[model samples]
Target chain A: MNFDEIYSSKLALVEDALKKLMERHKECPPTLFKAMNYSLFAGGKRIRPVLLLSAHELVGGNVEESMALACGLEMIHTYSLIHDDLPAMDDDDLRRGMPTNHKVFGEGMAILAGDALLNLAYEVFLENAMKYPYKLERHVRAAFVIARAAGLHGMIGGQVADLEQEGKDVQPDMLYYIHTHKTGALIEAAVRAGAILEPIEGDVEDAVAKYGQKLGLAFQIVDDILDVTGDAASMGKNPSRDEARKKPLFQLCMAWGNRGVWHGT
Target chain B: MNFDEIYSSKLALVEDALKKLMERHKECPPTLFKAMNYSLFAGGKRIRPVLLLSAHELVGGNVEESMALACGLEMIHTYSLIHDDLPAMDDDDLRRGMPTNHKVFGEGMAILAGDALLNLAYEVFLENAMKYPYKLERHVRAAFVIARAAGLHGMIGGQVADLEQEGKDVQPDMLYYIHTHKTGALIEAAVRAGAILEPIEGDVEDAVAKYGQKLGLAFQIVDDILDVTGDAASMGKNPSRDEARKKPLFQLCMAWGNRGVWHGT
Candidate 1:
């Protein structure tokens, strides 16, 4: 299949798997279920899961075999967005052309919904890993990669740095740290996890990880550019959000005269 | 060892492991690390971790071997507390004789701190489980139990139910649902996880799980009673807080004339 066809096919698998997961949770408290469903079903490109499936497929792994894990990655991504848009965090009222989760469900339920999504991500990972006893070790390792990327040392760590840098004269190195940890870590992890889940050679795994890292950094820069130039109609949220909040951006850092060094890194 | 001696010794192991985990994260952002450590090390009885270690011991597992998983359970418990005390939730200011996480760290940091703790809990679990390749299946099972107990079908489900019932006339069945899911699920999960981590027989696991379920219910009942009857000096929180919020409690449910049926269930 060509890139678009491959991407569409993989996206379909992820969407189907996520639907099944949600159907299983239909009996949960109505508000929590609805809130989680609202944000999860919100339109966004399934980049992380697509990256994971692409890497896995490149290594001759079956897309169906790792579909649950791809869905788990998407759940984690959705949960992070839900929490980030909370009144306490970025405080955005819109996401992907819809009112934020808290706007419709209330703040308390929003918090619980985020918590439930994060927990269920692990539940999905563990449940899927358990299905293949013979490949249990690699599965555990893949889950570990995802966990590390999502935890304090990775995405959350970067978030802390970013949150602390709000309205401050952020340094170039700090900006790099924030972007890498917050965005690059998980993207790199998705690719690495895919390689680890299959019987891949070490060099190939390293190459894929490097590719993911570069892609992640570029992705963040594009996001920063879009936030400055895009409009609400296309972006589905206010474009001036980061600038309004004085949230640090890669473009701001690049203007600080470290562009060459950053590109080298 | 006698019960007290065994409990004290297991407590020491868990405490030591937790300390090491904190020390490892000292290089992370200072505020996040401090926020996480503040509540994690706050003076409170280590019930969940203690239960996990004890259950593991009862099933002939070594305390030292399962120490990390026990600590992970404690982290999950701590994260739940941090989130529960948010202004939008229970709105408590004090916990275990100190300012709550959000009270000291601000709501935004407090939210991130809680999210980090929950993520780290899974990191700890997956990391520890990966250590024993020969026994990987059981370890995965143990982590799965913890994940399920903490997820929508377990603790978070209960929390949603409780949140929805605030200031309302709650039914006994609804109260039962809240108590069992919010409080009892993790307690029972700790015991079940302990048993699963070892090579225990199936009947023993069932018996231990049943014991955990009863203990979890009794524990909630005692907590409700304490909320009404205990002093601030003892309980380390405002005694009337739950009552003021009109929180659904076991005692209130009992007063609804389902005491006999509740006990039988």
Candidate 2:
């Protein structure tokens, strides 16, 4: 399939998976589950899980094997986003063209939603492991990859660095480290996870991982570019908020020296 | 060995393991490493890791294997404590006897320290998996146990519930759920992980898990009791802070309705 078609197809699968997952949580407290589903169902690119699925496909892995893994990655990504938007974190009021989780659900409920999502992510992964017909080795490897990506060395590490650099002129090396670990780590794990499941070896796994790494960084850079140039409506939130906060984006742009990059917003 | 002597010896071993882990981070920024070590070294009971080691001994598992697992558990625990004390989370000024991480280090550094410790925990586990002379299955199973305990279903779930109930009167069932999931999950995992490594089953494993569950709950309840009656200096922090903040503890105690019962602090 062409890129657009492929992306659309992958997203459809993700939407279906998410629908099933959210439905499972309905037996939980109604308001709490609704708030959880609100941010989860809120639109995003589903890039990490898609990367996982696509990489699995490329490696001749069964889509069945990847389905839960994809969903788990998305759960984690979504949870992080929810937490990141908390008043204690990014304090964003809008995301993906709608109110942020805390904005709609209140901070307390939003926090629970994020917590439930994080918990459910692992539960889903464990459930997948129990169901998968594969050897225990593959499941273990997958767990390690997912954990590393989600934990400090990968996404959380990046977040820590990113938070540290807030409102400061960060070095280029620090910026790269932040982006690679924080954003790229999860993306890389998505691709690598697929490869691991399929038992791909040698250069193929490495190549896919590299692709993910590059794409993740490119994605962040595009976000930066968009924050500078894209319309608030198109971007789904306030475009100038990052600038107003004097976040590291300004330092990154200055390092790139890209003035007048946007003619219109 | 008696419990006191064994505890002291295990503490020494844990200290060594923590020292080695901190040494690995020396190449990173000193401020970041120092903050990470500060929390790691800050004296807590080391209950989770100690339980793991004791369970391993009870099962006749290798001490080295148990030690590795214990170290990993401690790292996860320490990191969670650091994050838990953040201005956005509990906003505590003290943990154990020392200033909370964010108080000594800025909020940003404290955040990164937690992140780094979390990553290092996983790294240590991965290394153990690689080095184990036993079958990969055992290591993988152990790793899964740790991940499950540390991840959303375990500690993170409890944290979310605790945060959700902040400034609210929580029912006994809700309080039980929070404390069990938060504190009990990891403790149970510690015991179970040691058993998993040794390849035991039947009532033995179940008994160990049950013991851990009860012990974990008992520990938390005792902590609650301490907060109400313990000396601040002896406890190493403000014991009454929980009550002052109108946290869920008072509600929990009232729900239990054991005002006459006293567990020695």
Candidate 3:
């Protein structure tokens, strides 16, 4: 498939999965669920789950087997974004061309929405494990991988570093460490989990992992690049907003021998 | 062993396990590690881990084998507390008689510390699965159970309900739902995990589950009782804080025919 075709297909699957997941929460607090759906349904690339599914496909695994995990990964990513936008965190009033969750739902409900998403992510996985016609070991491995990547030493660790480095002239190495762990870890775990579930062996697993590492870093770099160069309307969020707030960026543009050069953004 | 002796021994073991787990974060950001240590060491009853250990003992399982899971449960609980104390959530300024994490470390760092503890909790479990002397299946099952309990249909779900109900006069049924899912789920998971690892069978598992359900509700009722009756100084916090804030109380008090009576102070 062409890039758009592949991207569109993955997006459709993710959207359907998320819609179904949110439907289950219909009877939950209506306002809170609305806030959750607002952020969850907000447009994004769905890169993490797409990459996971792609990795699974590369390993000859059926996408259906990894569907629950893919959706869970996206839920986590969405939940973090919701919390990160809270006034206590980034204080952003807008995301994806819409009001941030806390802005629309009030802070308390927003917090609940983020929390609900996190919990629901795992619930989706467990339900799948209990119901899917797959080997229990695969589900167990997937669960472990997702938990590790999402938890302390993975995305959360990166987040800690990122938050800590705010308003400071964070070193390139520190920025790299933060991004690689914060975003890169989960992306890596996503791919790894997919491969592990499919029982991919040896070099293929290593190759997919390498691909994930590169893609994750590349994705973040592209985001940095976009923040500097992309249109706010097109991106559905402000570019250069980080700079406006004096937040650290992973890239630096410098002149090198009369040539413009970009360092870590 | 007598109850006190058993409790003390179990507490001691859990303390040691927590120390070991904390050591793993030594290379983490010093501020983050300090924040994490402040709360992890601030100390509560360590009741959840203690329960898990006791259950393991009752099942004839080696406490050593289940120590990691015990620590994991405590980490999860501690992380929730740290997050709950945030300005956006419960907005507390004190915990366990000391300044709350955010008060000491600032909002950003406190948030990160909570996140790190959560991630580290899973990391500890993963390490156990990899290195523990048990069958892989057993470790996987244990990890899966813990993850599910901590996720949506478990602790976080209850938290969402509790958060949403903060200002409203929630029904008694709704109150039960919140506590049972929020606090009781993990408590149940802790005991269930121990039993799972110990390979406890049939009615024994069912019995332990029933005991856990009652114990968890009783524990919450006693907490509510203390919140009303205990000295704010001795309780290390306000005793009537829940009523002052209009938060839900356990229904056990109503069962005693004391519908509107506040207990502790």
Candidate 4:
């Protein structure tokens, strides 16, 4: 298969796995399950999970062994979106062309839903690791990489910085910190975790890490640029909110505008 | 040492471990770090961690080996408290005789702090587990137990139920469900995780589980009763709020008022 064929096939597998995982959780309260499912099944492109699976395949790692990790990465990504749209955060009313979790389920359940998703992500990771005890060390290592990326030093750290820098003149150093930590960390984790599932060869893991870091930053810059250039219908969410809220945008920074030259790294 | 001495020593050790964990993350944004530290070091008794250590000792689990799990449990407990006090949730202004996390750090930071703590908890657990690769299976099992207790099947499940049933006339079964899931799950998980750290022998694990469930239920009932009987000065927060909000409370249920009889299984 070519790149698109492999990507499409991997995406289908992730969707199937995620659907089964949600079905298993239907015994919880109807509202909570629905709230989680509504967002999980919302028209996300499954970029992070796809990245993980693709990277795993690139390294000749067993795709079956890394399925849970990929699904868990998607869950972490979803939970962050749910929390980010809360009234205290970005207060977004729409996500992926649907009402946000808080808008549909109310703020309290949305908050709990996000918490539950995060908890369930770890639950899924640990459960899968326990099932394959011989490979438990690799699973633990992968989970640690993902956890650190999702925690203070990674995604959440970037979010806090972004929140603080909102509507203020942000230094270039701070802008890089916010973008890299917020958007880049988890993306980097996806690739590194995929590669780590197989034993590391000399320089392979380091090269994979560098690739992930660059991919993550490029992904965020493109996303910010889309917010400036894309329309609401195509983007699913309103493209103007970030600019209206005066968020630190790559397109707005004149000092860093030399498109092909990476200055702040 | 007697029970009191053992308890105090364990408590001291947990506090120290938690403090060090917080100190390590000072490189994150200052507001985020302070928000997390504020709620973490709040003056609540370290009941969950103590329960874990006590149960570990009862099962002859290595105390040194279980330290990270204890601190991780505390982080989960703290994160739950921070989220529960959000304006979207209980909206309380005070916790443990001081301002709540959101009140001090603003709602966005508080939310991120809670997310950071939860992510950090898993990080600590995985990091500790990896250090003892030979014992990795046991750590995975224990972590799975905690994750389930904190996820939709346990604490978050109960919280959702409680939110849905608020200010409504609830049946005894629903009340029991809410209490068991919301408060009892983590408490039970504490004992179970502690015991699982060591290999189980015979009926001991079953007996420990029963003890945990009953103790958890009893602990919550006593807390509800304290709200009715104790003063705000003693309780550290307003005692009237739960009743004002018409939350389901054990003291308000008349059908189960025969104090000696266990009404629901």
Candidate 5:
């Protein structure tokens, strides 16, 4: 299959898994679930989960085996988006042509919904990990990479720095850290996490992670470039929103596209 | 050692672990870490970690083996408090005579700090679990219990229900579900987590968990009773605060304590 066909098929697998898992948990409070589901099911490309499955496939792992984890990644992404849109954060009202979680449910329930989604992400990962004790070590490692990548050292760290640097002069290194970390870390981890599903050698793992990193960096730069070039109606988000905020997002892209996507020599 | 001495020693171990772990993450932003540490280091009895250690000991597990997980539990509890005291949540300013996380840091930072703590807790758990793969199936199980207990079906679930019921008539079943889930689930998980550290049988695990459930319920009742009867100067916060909120908190205690802590036969 071509890239679109392959991506769509993998995306279907992730969606099916997420739907079944969520449906199983009927006990989750209705209103809170509504808020969480609102964000979670809001249509997106599911790039992270698809990337994870592709990486898993690249390293000779089954999509079925990684289905729960793939869905879990989407949930974490959704939760981050929900929190990021809160009044204290980006304060956006519309997401993907729909009202954001906070907008529909109120900020309080939105926060709870994000919390629930995060907790459920781990639950999904752990539940999947529990089924395969013989490979418990790898599953634990995978979960760690995902959580750590989305964690303070990775996403949250970048967020803190960005929030701190708001309306201030941001240095190149700090700005680089913000985009690569805030956006790219988890993307890198998703690919690396998929690659590490099976027992791979150290050099191979390093190479795969490096590749993932380059891919992640490229993805972010393209995202920024899209913001400059893509139409608002199609992109669903306003074009040049980041540049409009007066941050030098394009410098990093120019630096990368001019030099190769990967940083190391 | 008496209970105090033993408790203090274990408490010291948890504190040291937490300190070392936090210190190891020096890369975390200063402001964000400051907010997290403000709440984490604020003086309160380390009851959760202590219970974990005691339970681990009761199940013949070494403290060193469980130290990381023990500290992880406290991190989760600390994160809960930070979020709980947010302006949108419980809105408490002073916790243990010091400013709450949001009171010290702005609301945005406090939220991030709580997110960081919760993420860190799982990271700590997985890091410790990674050290010994042979016992990982059980470690995965233990982590699942903690996550599940603190998750939407447990603590978060309870918190959501409580928030929804605010300024409304709270039925006894709803009240019971709130306390048992909001407070008791994690408390019970702490005990069960320690019990499973060494891989005990099903019946033993059940009995230990029962003991934990009883202990947790008793603790909450006594906490409510103390609010009605205890001195404010010693309690460090105002008594009857829950009552002042116009909730029949003590009534549940009176109904339970006057009868029995556990409702299930």
Candidate 6:
């Protein structure tokens, strides 16, 4: 498969599904909904959601069964991005060539938008899971894995470490820990959740998880690299943000050798 | 039962459960866990969790079955408190007689701790839900209700409105909307979820929900009243902060009628 074509196709599918899922309701506050839709629709590659879809498809699991999960994963990812860009955090102004959620909507509304998205993600998935009478176990298991991946031991913990380590990190283990738990955990969960939608063997799940881990690290390293090399117009956001923050990833890889050898390092 | 006595008893139970729940794993960053525990153990009245327990008991639901949910409700409540106290949000420095999460742990760690608590709340309830093979639907339904109560149309919407309406004139309806949504929705959900642990009639559920609405409204009105009238020593956090922000609540009622007639006003 042409990876770019597949990425585009899955991105379209997720974007369409997310639009439907996030359709404005009459009772919803107009501005709150607007803020949520603003960052949500401001596109990314939809890597997590597409991984969910592709995992389900690869395992010959019912692709339909994974749609809501796919959408839910993307919502979770987007919510994190919104919060991560807040003034208290990265203090970012631009995302995907658009104003960051907090920048456009004010800090308070952006926070609410992120909170709304997080809560709504569970609503979407749980509402979908309620329909599966026979395979409710699968649904529960998928939800469990995803929730764990998103919780204290996973994304949030890594985030805490990453923030604490900012401007002061010095260890290889800490870097690996932050990169893996912060980024890799949820990515692994995306693939694992999709594969477990049906039945699968232990070995297959392990292999998929390993693949996800490497891919997630690669994804983060590439992000760090792109932030240095890519221009604002093509990249949809400013470059050199990583260097300015003195973030650990690209700096460590450069310490090791060329960027191309980041993976082996 | 002496309501105060019962409140103490349930509060103890929830605090115990929450203490156990927040017992930090070695793997989790110590600072993040410390921040979470600081706010969590700072000790509120535990009204939401108590309400949950009472509702479950009142409905002849198994009291033991509702424990995780009660803890989860309180976790959600405490997480909201932590976020609301942030500099970008309410900017409060003290909570429950102690320095607020950010003041004690810095803004970034506090934010992540709040996020972790929120995610962990779902994990707690979902993990508990997976145990009841016979009544899995009840768990799903309860999760759905709780998620919606905390989402955009519920707490988050109210928060956005409350923040936007700050330092501005507003209508009575808007005040009611903000109070009911910001403070009332989760309170209402805590009860409704506990009540629905077993089957009940439409009228019964409606009655519980209506009771919750009134209680939640009254709860906020009382809080607003306390912020103005009560001493900081008794209330833990300093009073009159709401007045400083020009928040809409007790002022509206007092403007309309005497303080004693707050409920009808």
Q: Ten-residue segment with the worst summed lDDT in candidate 5 chain B?
A: B238-247
User: Please, what are the lDDT tens digits per residue for candidate 4 over residues B1-265?
Assistant: 9979987898898889888877877889988998989999997689998998888988887777888998999999999999988888878888898989999999999999999999999999999999888788988888889999999999999989988876677667787788788999999899988998888874787778768887887887887777777776788876746554344564445534543325433
Instruction: Give the lDDT of residue A73 in candidate 2.
Output: 85
Q: Write the per-residue lDDT of candidate 1 for residues A18-100, one digit (tens) a residue.
A: 89989987888888899999999998789999899888888999877777778888889898888888888888888998999
| Candidate ordering by DockQ (highest first) | 4, 1, 5, 6, 3, 2
Q: Per-residue lDDT tens digits of candidate 3, residues B1-265?
A: 8989989989998898889778865875678888989999997789889888888888898899889989988988988888888777778887899998989998867766776676577667766766654455676567677777776557776877777777677677677777778888889888888887866677898778767876777787877767766875787755534453344443445743343223311
Better of 3 and 4 by DockQ: 4
Query: In order, what DockQ does each candidate have?
Result: 0.84, 0.26, 0.41, 0.87, 0.75, 0.65
| Candidate 3 chain A lowest-lDDT run of ten | A253-262
Which stretches of candidate 1 lie above 4 Å from their native place?
Answer: A242-265, B244-265
TM-score of each: 0.94, 0.83, 0.88, 0.94, 0.94, 0.91
Q: Please, what are the lDDT tens digits per residue for candidate 6 over residues B35-122?
A: 8878877868888888888898998987679988888888888888888887777778778888888887887677778888888888
Please report how far candidate 6 places residue A50 from its true position, in Å: 0.7
Chain B TM, every candidate: 0.92, 0.90, 0.90, 0.91, 0.92, 0.90
Clashing pairs in 5: none
Interface C-alpha RMSD, model 5 = 1.0
Q: Given candidate 1, what's the lDDT at residue A74?
A: 88
Q: How well is candidate 4 docked (DockQ)?
A: 0.87
Q: Model 2's CAPRI class?
A: acceptable
DockQ (C-alpha) of model 3? 0.41
What is candidate 2's lDDT per residue for A142-183, written digit by digit as tens?
A: 756887788665777677666666667667778777777778
Candidate 6: interface RMSD equals 1.4
**Each candidate's interface RMSD, rounded to one decimal?**
0.8, 4.4, 3.4, 0.7, 1.0, 1.4
Better of 2 and 6 by lDDT: 6
- The regions of model 4 sitting more than 4 angstroms off are A240-265, B244-265
Name the candidate, 3 or 6, with the larger DockQ value: 6
